[model samples]
Target: MDGLYEQFRIALHQVWQRRWLAMAVAWCVAFAGWVAIALLPNSYEAKAKLFVAFDNMVPTAAAASQNPQNDIMRLKQTLTSNENLTRVVRRTDLNKLVTSDAALGGVVAGLRQRIAVVAQPDSLFEITATSSFAGLSNAENARTSAAIVQQLVELVTSGQLAGDPQRTQQSLTFLDEELRRREQQLQEAEQRRMEFEQRYMGMLPGTGTVADRMAAARTELAQLEQTIVAARSAVNAMRGQLAATPATVPIPGAENAYAGTASGQLAGLEVQLSQYLGRGFTEQHPDVISLRSQIARLGPQAAQERSRGSAAGNGIPNPSHVSLRAMMSEREAQLAAAESRRAQLQADLAQLGQRDSAQPGAAAEQARLTRDYDVLRQQYDRLLADREQLRLRSDMQTQASAMVVRVVEAPRAPSGPTSPNRPLFLTIVLVLAIGAGIAAAFLKGQLQTTFPTANRLASVTGLPVLGAVGEVVGRAERTRRRQRLVWLVGSGGALAASYAALMAAEMLQRGPVA
Candidate 1:
């Protein structure tokens, strides 16, 4: 512990004795460092914050285009693109210095590093531009930073707004041309269908495909055959009932001829005809016409025999038998009509089948035509929808969804240099200079051959030294030493004062003088 204290004391004395050298070195280092720091170009930075909101007012088309992240990504790319940087160079005072293509390219390359675009959540963008351009004043660089940021934003905004309309118009034109082509195709298909039907009108069915009509006709033909069979069975049942019942009931005092009169038979036939009419059989029905013919044939005979049939109340008409015969006639007529319909339907189906077999490619050709028409129709409809959407987008206001950038904070010239941190750096340099000077003085003291302490001398020489004595000086010498001390103190104070001055100068600076 004693040795350490002794060494510390020796070091303090060494520093004090070389104080003048330390002051000179400190002054030189501080001044040189301050000059170098001052000579470095100041980097002025401008910053802007923007808010982007998308409001696509078009109907039903916003869903596919509502991606804010993609829009923000595009904004980032556009902001730093070469085209935007080129525009920035032209719009700012930087253009004056960059006359040649090489100069412009170099400036644009430098601008790439200087500009920064940061995208934040909730559609916020932070745009920062820095300028450390040479041959320009710090104030000019500060202004240029703001101008470049503004120009970049303007370029991006104008680009998004302007390019959309032209592209939309082009799309609309293309869709229109496609629609016309599709329309022409649709007409040609219709013409082909018409000509095909006309050429094979006798064989091919109208209003439906041959197969569909054939299937339908076959189904109906089967149903008609079933109806005909059922009707024939019903007519046979009625005939059996008529066979069981006699046409007339005989009485005790009448002749057999007198029992069955012509009037009564005619009346029975007329009654049957009336029943057929009441049952919704039209006058044009075969049964109804046949009954009318029979009535006509029997009318004159019945007129002559009416009195004889009245006189003989011997035979009376059986109503049940008459009714059965009338019903049988109606059923037989229906069966005949069904048979006729079945024959006609069979003939039509045969013709369709034969036509299809003869042509062999009719169904395939029709199928291909239908398929082509359907495909073209679907494509035309899709293009129509797309065209409508494009029209909506084209009709948007000048500053529409894509041009939604809002200047939350406009870019402005910086009041101070962003880099170099001058005041702090100046203080660091001052401290380092002072430290270097102290180190130099300490090294010089160590280089000397003399030793201030007896122990130090003894340790070095490996000899025994008893002690050391202090120097006794006259009052005048002491005064002289005091004067030297004051000079040394003043020199150090001046160095400190210069450091303070540099710091003050740095702090007082708002920006470069214009």
Candidate 2:
């Protein structure tokens, strides 16, 4: 512990002995550092916030614009593009430095790096511009930063400038031409379809192809056959019924009965029974069974009185038999009509078979042509719709200036430098200067052969050393030491005062920016 303390004391004494050289070194370092700091141009920042609503900018039918990520990215890229930056440069103080194309390119490149556009949630955007052009004054750089942000805002707000005018116009023209071509092609395709229908498919039933019509015809023939068989069975049943019915009714219960009647009422009763049967009534119907019973009851009576019939001596003609015969004839007529339909259907089937042999691929060709026509129609409609939307969009952009960006906060130049942190940098340089000075003095002490103490001297020499004598300061020597001390204090105070003055100047320099 004592050895460490003694070493520390020796270092302190050595540094004190070369204090003037240390002060001189510190002055040199501080001067260079402060001057370098002063040479750094101030970077002024300008910022603005915008509400970017995309709903009104693009049509809802535009599929690519469903997500806003692409739009935001495009906006960011466009704001920093070289053309916009060139315009910004021309409109600001940076225009003075752009003497040629190369100069403009350099300026634009630097400006692009300094500008930042960030998208926030809820369709918000923040645009920032930092200007630190070495060629311009600090205040001018601040003005240029604000101007840059303002120019970008203008670019975004201008409907015509939001997108390329020439490209939009070209797209509209191209779509118009394409739509016209599609219309012509559609007309030609429709004409071909009509001609095909008239020439090839005209003989087929309905609008179906040959095979479809043939299948439909066969199905109809099968159903018609069932109807014909049912009608034939009904006709046969009606024929049997008519043959079983007698053409006369016997006179009932009396001699000299009328020739046209059984007791002059048998024919009327028979007619009523036939009417019941014709109304789709069953044999189980009460009236029909009752009439049959009455007729059977009168049969014996009429046979007993047959010799006593009228002069005509013929039983009344049964209207029931006539009704049954008429029904049978009507059923036969219906069956004949059904047979005629069946023959016509068979002939159609034969004709379809022959057509199939003649043109085997007619159905497939028709289907393909119809499919192509439908697809073309759909595509043409889609193009027409898109062209209309594009035209409206273009008109809105040109005449109405529909695309709008609302500025929530307008861009303004900063009142102070955003970079360099002058106060902190000055402090750091001061500390570094003092540290360097102390290091220099310590290094000088280390290089010298002299030792500050007996212990240190012995340690290095490896021998016992005699005690050293203290130097006696006379009055003249003390006076000269005081003068040197004064000079050192003055130099140190001058450096400190320079730092304070620089700090004060930085504070005062903000007035112009504000």
Candidate 3:
């Protein structure tokens, strides 16, 4: 370790001996760095700010229906699109200085990167722009910034308003179509109701609609009345026929029940005996015996009466027994005819009642259809109202839902160029050059590994140092040494080269002012 330390010290001393050369290289490199920075053109940066705010209208159900958030999102996308940027480029005439098309692309890209379009926290947007112009004035920078932000605002605003006409037109068209359809539906419904009324006219009572159960009942009553009328007519006609017909016409060979026969004489004798008994005659009295004898004598008469006649004239006519029998037969015939007619009328009435029972279902369906049409019509009307309100809003005098940009901090002409920070550049150059110079000197010394110190030579070769000697020279010896070009020439040339490099570095640092 000691040996290595001694070797390093010797190496450092050798580098010091050539210190001029190291200093020269460092100074040259640094000066070159300064000159490079000086020759490059200076650039200026300009920035501007834009403040944005969305519509602050009070939110109503109407506003919610419009979906204003969608509008805001669309505004964001429109502001960022290439078309808007291109418009900004044209308005700013950025192409004048940015000559080449490809170069212009790069400039535009750079502009986009530098510029910012950020929404402020809980507010609208903040737009910013930065540009580099070699020697632009304060006014010019301000104008550029203002122009860019303003153009961006216009681009976004125009885009926002772009779809208005088409949207409005489409709305109008839709409303018109809906109105027409609704009108048609209402008319058709009315026509259908009228047709239904006409078809069943008087079949349904008041309201002429079977929608009312009472009306249906009344209609049934009307049909029943017609049936009753027919029934009554048939009964009257049967009664008239029974009244006109003869009552006692014989039923031909069944004549034992007829008048003027021995059965009549015998029926008379029995009536007399019943009367005498009612007068309190005794069963064995003479009057009773005479009645009995008369009854006996009429026995043949009774048989004759049974065969062909009815008893007559014994103070009471025999009640026309044949006529009564014939009248009973006629009455039975009349009853049969009336009953058949009543059955037919009853059948017709049942059919009418069945029809009346089904009426309510049909009427209810029609009512449901009517209600649906009415509701749809109302919806269409409300939509129309909303559209009209929007149209009015567009026409009305009011502030636009847009932000105003203000220049909070105006740009100023810089006192010194922002670029080419001289001191910083110089420091960077000095540090790098010093590092390179030190490294080169150390590396050269290591690679050469010259035996500059007596100790180094002694240690490496194990040689003994006999004595350290300093040269003792006379004038002649010095002159002879100088005459030998090898040593003297090399030393002189090295010093001259070092001095020349220093002068050149100084000259390069301070060029012509212009």
Candidate 4:
């Protein structure tokens, strides 16, 4: 410890002997460092806070599970995107300053680097922008910083207000068009279903499984058979009533020599004679001659009796017999219709019974068509539902009921520059300059190849040093030493003047420290 102290003392004495050289080195290093620090541009940062709110107005289950932080992060990315940066540049004075398009890209990149985004809890965020300090005035730097931050806020807010709404409206229009297209498709599908049903008719698998369809067909067939039986019974009853009634009535002034005194007997014979005549019997033939003689004989007697105004009228037809004949005709027509219906029912039942025996290929094709129709129907329904949801979402967005962003704290002009701490820079420069000067002195001493102290000399020579010799001051040597001193002083003065001039020029061109 004593030896280290002694060595330190000796080195201090050597440094003191060359104090002028040490001072020159220190001054040079310090001035250079000071110039470098002074030339560094100052940077000013401005910050503002923003608050985002998630409205979740659409009332969807997914909305509850949605992460607001993800939205915030996405917004941050959008704010810093190249396109947004370009827009910001165009809106600000950057456009005028950067004339070349190629150079503008670099400027935008640098601007991006100067921006800082900090996400906070509760959907709060902070946006910061930094720029090189402008003019000498602190107000100018503050104004620049504030302007940048304000522009950023405007960009974000304007994008939210204008872009988001327009995008939502566009989406709504697209959805509306899609819904129309889907409706058209649904109509076409419905038409296809109708055609298919018409083509297959009772063969379709309607409302139930194959077994159920067969059961329904069988039940309908049985009902039709019962209806046919009832129709036949009604026809038979009408026929019996018609058989008991007379076919015709006696005509007035007709002869009665052909049969009994009953006018109906004479009417019946006349009807038979007419039938024979209608069968192509000539009037001169025996049958026709006999019928004609009979009619001529009965005509007078019947007319005389009719003129007597007898209580029993024989020329008029029986109303009951006429009614029974009409009923019989109606029953026959009904029986025909019922038989037709029964035949159709039988055919349908046969088809249902043979469904399993039908061609496998046809059955598979029918199933495929039915499945396709069902799928299309389901798809149409789903699209209809989605269209409604999209419409609701669009309305909510239009009303600004969804996610919202607002400036929580407006940006203000800074009171001072945030970067290029003048005092701190000067302190670092001083320390570095001192260190450089000390190193230079040691290097100069080493280049001399001579012992700087007695301790060093003793260690090198392995000898004991009794004393140190002092150089004799000759006249010429004294003059040379004086000249060297003057030169050193002049050089140091010139260096100081140069440094001061450079600093003054820099202050004039760039701004003074804010």
TM-scores, one per candidate: 0.51, 0.54, 0.38, 0.47
The CA lDDT of each predicted structure is: 0.77, 0.80, 0.57, 0.68
User: lDDT score of model 4?
Assistant: 0.68
Which stretches in model 1 have alpha-carbon errors above 4 Å? 56-66, 156-403, 511-514
Write model 4 residue lDDT over 173-249, tens digit each, in one string. 88677778877877877676667555445563345434456566667667768887898888887775564455545
Q: What would the per-residue lDDT of candidate 3 be over residues 1-514, giving only the tens digit for each residue? A: 9979987787677666565566667767766876786566543344334343445364555444334444455555556555566667777746455767776676677657756665554434555565454444433544555566666665554444344455557877887787778777777776776665554443434553344634455465566566656656665755544433322333445345443445544555566776777689988989889988987897776565434534322223324444545555665566566556556545544554576576646566556656766776687678778767766544331333443334444434333334555556656776776776666677777787577767767888898977677769999998886676455456546544644564465345434211
True lDDT of residue 250, candidate 2: 51
Model 2: residues with Cα > 4 Å off, grouped in runs: 56-65, 100-102, 160-404
lDDT at 479, model 4: 100
The candidate maximizing lDDT is: 2
Q: Taking the tens digit of each residue's C-alpha lDDT, what string does model 1 give over 1-514?
A: 9878988899889988888888888988998999999887889999888888877655455445445676567568656767667777888988877979998999999989988889887788888999998867777888898998888767655554234455557878999999899888878887877776665444433356556656667788889988988998888877756654556654556655553776656757766876786689998999989998988997788666545565246566767878888888888888999999888878777776787789989877777776777787788788888887666545553335545677888888788889878888888888988898889889999999878888788989999998788899999999999999998889888878887887788767653532
For model 2, residues 199-267, the per-residue Cα lDDT tens digits are 666654555655676677778899999999999899888775774566565546433446444544554
List the candidate numbers ranked by TM-score, top first: 2, 1, 4, 3
When 1 and 3 are scored with lDDT, the better candidate is: 1
